[model samples]
Target: MRPLDLLLAVGVMLIWGYNFVIAKYGLAELPPLLFMALRFGLVALLLVPFVRMPRGRWRDVLILAVMLGLTHFSLMFVGLAHVDAAVAAIVIQVQVPASAFLAMVLFGDRIGWRRALGMAVAIGGVAILAGEPRHSSALWAIGLIVTAAIVWAGANIQMKRMTDLDPSTINGWMSLLAAPMLLCASLLIEDGQWQAVTRASGWAWMAVAFQAVIVVIFSYAIWYRLLRTYSVNQTMPYTLLVPVFGVLSGVLFLDEPASWSLLLGGIATLIGVGIIILRRPKAVEAQAQVT
Candidate 1:
């Protein structure tokens, strides 16, 4: 890859990694489902005008909107509210190995010994992280995130079967569909959303805008380009930096405590995910979702 494109790839990682902290701050001023509703609604408003609608692939598109966009973010933010951004960032990496596990089970994809071992190591690392005594009280929240990761991995598997789906417009359509569903969910399950939206700080609103515009739209646009222009080996490896920046951002920006178990377990998890991502065939393109 060229120097400029490499920098772009790294920029995407930074945007996505920093978003963990961003979402945590955003959640302070907005309810999770309410915030997600606004974020996806704005994304749809911005993107739907530019991209073509998914006419024939509505089945796959709706599945993504409901499962990944609505359900995943709902669980993630709820879990994030009880945990540190660094933990959320690191824990979600479980999806990498889980995706591999699902691929092997559902599609009969070959899981070489190295990958199976990597998956085991990754799961073990997450167990260590989850068992950290400093945050053991939040096990229910952690469990929610783990469940979300598995569901997200399932969405990833479903995406693999959608050979005809266009990456460029699918996010737009998903957002368009999910925004209303999220709004309905928030109304049903949450309280004080009206107060939350009305009394939100400027920075809080900016955080929402940052997530919708920069993280989802801008970074994804660049990442899709990088994936199309370069081999998966060239573009995908830079994503390893997400947890590093995630940890750093939480520590530096949010003053979040980083326990020993967090550091060690996160390292182990990333190493295993590294194995899974790096071992992929050169030609196989990874799904563009980062969160």
Candidate 2:
């Protein structure tokens, strides 16, 4: 990667890493589903006019809308509401191994012993993290986040299948389809949404806008451009920095306590994910880029 592109990649990671803390702030004021609805709605409003249709792939785009936009994000924010941001960051890396396993099972993608061991180590680290005493009360939340990761991994497989679509187009249509569905879900399942939206603090609304505009639209535009400009190996490795920044931001901004178990398990988890990401075949690495 060129130095300029390297800087851009790192910028995206920083924005995304701090996004956990930002989402935590927004979720404080709005219901999880409602917050997600607003975020996607804003993205759709901003980008739908600019994004071209995926031509023959509308059905797949809708599936991505439901899977990535609705299911994964809803569970993620709800889980974040219940658990510490640092934990959410570390645990979400499970998507790496989860995607690898899914590729093997669903697509008959072969995994070498090294990748297999990486998957085991990553899962084991998550188990250790979940078993920590400080996080006992959050086991349900952790479970939700892990399930979200699986859903996210599934969406990645879908993305891999539709490799011809532009990333921005996919994202735009997904946001367009998802906004209404998520709003309907929020209306059905959550209470006091009107009150929450009306009473939301300025900072909370700013967080929502930031997530939509900066994290979803701007960061992804840069990310896709980098992927187009450089090899996946050059760009994908920088994503490991996301969890690192997440942990650090959680500690600094939220004053979240990181127990020894969290630190150790997080390191082990990231290491395992790094192994899977860095050492996997190029084909597998390309699939992992969808995350």
Candidate 3:
């Protein structure tokens, strides 16, 4: 990666890191689901013109929209609403392992014993994190967040299948498709919708705009470009920083607790997931040939 690309990746890390804080703050003014709906709606509207639905990928786009956009974000925001952002950040990092496991089962992608052990360790960390309820509904909320991760991984795998399309096109069109359903769900589930809209402060409005435009649209477009230019394993590890940022941002902004279990579990999860993440696709293929 060039210095500029590295910088862009770092910038993405910071934005996503602080995303938890932004969402937490934004949710203070609006319902979690509604906030997601509005955020994606703004993203969809902005990208509506430039986004073209790719050939041979309408179904993939819809699947990605549901997996990546609606199911992932909705569960994530709801989980964030219930749990501490920092821990939520750490817990969500388990998505890497979730993806690895799903790949093994769904696609017959190779998973060596080392990666399997890492998965076990990662799940164990989650268990430790969940055992402590005083830390903020760790059990139920973690389930929601993990579900978001699995869905996201499935979406990513789907994205990888659409070889002709770029990531920007996928990101834009998926957001547009997912927005309306999110909006309708928000309306049905959350109250004080119009009031939240009317009473939102300038900063809150800016938060929403920042999330929609910067985080969801522009940054993701840049990320997908990076994914195309680089290897997935190389790019995927960079996302590990997102949760790191999430922890830091939540601590600084939300004053979320920095407990021992969170730190320990986070470290264990990172180390475990890193084992799987740092492995090369070629190595996996080689290992598969042997097995």
Evaluate residue 247 in candidate 3 and report its C-alpha lDDT on the 0 to 100 scale.
83
Number of the top-ranking candidate, with TM-score as the measure: 2
lDDT per residue (tens digit) for residues 99-171 in model 1: 8877777767678888887888888888889888877799999888988998899887677667465565888
**Candidate with the greatest lDDT versus the true structure:** 2
Consecutive 10-residue window with the lowest summed lDDT within model 2: 282-291
Ten contiguous residues minimizing lDDT sum, candidate 1: 282-291
Residue 90 lDDT (model 1): 87
Model 3 scores worst on lDDT over the 10 consecutive residues at 282-291
| lDDT value for model 1 | 0.86
lDDT of each: 0.86, 0.89, 0.78
Error of 3 at 278 (Å): 0.7
Query: Which is the winner by lDDT between candidate 1 and candidate 3?
Result: 1
- Where model 2 places Cα greater than 4 Å from the true spot, the runs are 286-291
For model 2 the TM-score comes to 0.96
Better of 2 and 3 by TM-score: 2
